[model samples]
Target chain A: MNNMRVLAEEEETSDGVEVTWEDQQQINTFAKLNARLKGIEDKLEQLKQEKEALDDLSTELELTDEDQTVLYKLGESFLHLPQPDALVRLEIDQASVSSQLAKLGAVAEECERGMKDLKVRLYAKFGKAINLDE
Target chain B: MVEQKFPESLDKNPRGIPKAPFIANVEEYIGGPDGDVEGPLKDFQDAIAKYRYMDGSLTQRRKGLEDKIPDIRKTLQMVEFLKQRRDRKQKADDQEDDLEEDDENSEGAKKPLTTTFELNDTLFAEAQLDDTDTVYLWLGANVMLSYEIPEAITLLRSKLDAAETSLKTAIEDLEFVREQLTVMEVNTARMYNWDVKRRRERRSAEEAAKREKES
Candidate 1:
């Protein structure tokens, strides 16, 4: 009853299915949320691939202070850092970097929760998925 | 000319938000002296052109925002993934005390791992990897350096953090664009409805005058 009141203005076409102005607005919102969800999923997959690449690189070497000059990326440029110092800094920086991952994971989960909320609302309103493409 | 009043429903509600100025101007042009439709018709055309220009630019801006969201999302995801991988390894490393065991056995460990090293696209060399030998990392821009595994993981993590910050900003921008697009859609709909009502009134009045003259 409350939903019907909220969806107050209904228009009946030649064929008898009832639709409201509110429903149209909700449908548009649903479509936009769906698009955003897709973007989030794609980004997550790319992050995984980058991690795997780093794992492979780490498995291949035994670095020490006596080794050749090490190149570290700084913005768009690469600068030479002493192999020993680079190793020390990287080891120290790893803990903070790992924590950053945890924070990002939380953000990703929040995004998913928001999407689920929108999806439930959309399903309740339409009874079934509305095919805007058609 | 018969002074016929337009329907009350067609009149703009004074209590509500003012109707688009273009619609009111068109009414004045069509309803004005000599009842010349051309001046008002030109005004109508200019309004449509202006509306279309605004619509096109807004749509283009939305599309640009959409394209950028995915790219930024990818960078964010990459950082997250690297962090995850590092965390997992750190967990396993914490449970074990044999972090240097592999390297220690590399010298006396009887297994000479014969591996092919690809020096260049068409060049390869057979080399024996000792258990203690360090791994060489190919840092982009043709630079290579040997690093302990933990150091390498940390280095990658820093990159991930940088990427994540950029992605967060990009997503915020995308959300702002989405909000703007929704507002644009509502305004466009209201303007279109107003224009149609004005056209209908003009057509019906012309039809009524023609009928009266014929009789």
Candidate 2:
């Protein structure tokens, strides 16, 4: 057990630097940024999926006649409305979803930029000792 | 439900024995005029790497099982609650008809279960669950199916049992992997110490021979 502990410690400091307070702070910041980036990426992926589903629905709606009454899901119930009204509602939803996706994409880009800057600083200080990538 | 089967390799070793053989005498284990310790050290390193990889995957599997168990339990609870509420309403209705034909009393006895359900996000709306023999369950991929109360309960119960059994197996596999890791680490440490001792003895013996020639 004692030998195992020593071996584990060696692996941690294998980059050949004794961890100082400043270095530890930088490491923690990198971890926090990485986690935030991951969350944003997940949201971005989900929004993309939502956009694809909405597009498919729009294509199907275009094939239906304007005089037909279409069923639109609202909350827990369905609303039977004219095809024109349903198309308008779908258009409004698609617009909102697209705007949200754009905003998330911009934020994700900013996050990636920040991570890159941090990576450069960390690598400069620790050389090959610190691992910044997942 | 299908029976849960763990890997045969993990199940084969009931006794906790190190996969790598222990070096009783390090000198004899690496016996040679040159004392070639590199080959044995490389073998030990490979075994440790293999064990570490197994440990990593086992830990991930254990985590997945842990997350799924709670979801199964929650679903089971919901189904059981629905079944209980249906049974209670049925009993109340039968008693009201048998005892008296009072309209007001019958209305009170057949009162529906009122609750709030989420509309979207944080928004919710008040709703009442009327007397119904069937409930719909979302079977993923946009498909939903209606099943009677008794049938739903049985299905949920069976699913819960299977998830629980799988979780137990995952936990056992994780423990077995950890034990193997410890044994491999101890073997590596022993081999390393033996090599250092052998090198020191060789150096001191050479110095002694030089001193005798100077005298």
Candidate 3:
């Protein structure tokens, strides 16, 4: 957290250009939020890819005979199950992945909202003097 | 504002050793009678650039670890799963032996675990998984070695721990490098401000002296 803290000192003669510690702190918070949002975005992308893979597997499973023993990958290992059972398992996995994606998407939205609030406050105070864009 | 004066560097010891104090008083910190500003500013710029470079590499390292940790965990999970399945099969075989002696032929006729495996991108092949006591693992660099279930589990566990430790270190190093970069940037700003103040004061004093001589 020390790395996140900006220098906190008051300057007597500001000339409207000096970055007050408060502004610096807001900037730091914005930056931290930005990084967090980026991480969440990356995770969302990965989860989306996983969901796509699951969808492809589901399609493949549907084409197999009803009594055929299809393989459903659980964790890193595959489970041999009847076609219907495999479809059910794949649905469950897809649901779990979709839920994860939704959760991350919500968290990313919250992070973006927080960044927007900080941008508003900081921009109000510093105007063109600050560069809060990523 | 004065009451909020905290230590310039928030973390006292980021890497288990204290860092040199941030340049609090830029004029004095730069250290020249005439308030030599350019040289120290240039040095700070170079240092900031170095720190930025380090941050870039550390970020990449962190990403690599992030990708690797999950991969190791997945491999470890597979190994453990295989071991468990093998143990269960062994237990069932033992139980069957105790229950009946005539079931020996049926054991040989038992159905293999059939699965579809990807042979290449989007190309799948149907394969039967045989009940085996050993599994082959890729050890990287064109090397593949077979290990018994228990041995593979132990090896993978150790490797996962090492990878996790390295990931922790990489993240900490990235944070430290970013903090250093921030400190350098703040120093540069402060030095520039101090130089501007000095020049303005000197100019005002010169104007006052000229007016006194004329009067």
Off by over 4 Å in 3: A1-26, A48-66, A71-81, A84-134, B1-24, B31-33, B98-110, B118-126, B141-143, B207-215
Instruction: List candidate 2 stretches off by more than 4 Å.
Output: A1-134, B1-11, B14-35, B102-109, B119-121, B139-143
Q: What does DockQ come to for candidate 2?
A: 0.02
Reference-based lDDT, each prediction = 0.47, 0.67, 0.71
Q: For model 2, how does the per-residue alpha-carbon lDDT over A10-119 read when each residue is reduced to its tens digit?
A: 65456365445455556655665666578678878988998999999999999999877676654333445467757876886799789989998897888788788878
> Scoring only chain A, what TM-score does candidate 2 earn?
0.83
Per residue, candidate 3 scores C-alpha lDDT tens digits across B125-164 of 7778788889898999999999998998999899989988
Top candidate on TM-score is 3
What C-alpha root-mean-square deviation, in Å, does candidate 3 show against the real structure?
7.9
Cα deviation at A28, candidate 3, in Å, is: 2.6
Q: B1-215, model 1: which lDDT tens digit per residue?
A: 33223222232322321122312233343565335444444444444454455446545665665555455444334333334434544454554456644342232223333445446676856555443323455566999887654565556556556555555544544443443345335434433433554455666799999999999
- CAPRI level of candidate 2: incorrect
Q: Top model by lDDT, which number? A: 3
- Candidate 2 per-residue lDDT, tens place, B43-159, comes to 667767876887788678867876776676666655665575567567767877798554543444366655455688778676767778887876679998999978887877887
**Residue B79's lDDT in candidate 2:** 63
TM-score: model 2 vs. ground truth: 0.52
Query: Cα lDDT of model 2 overall?
Result: 0.67
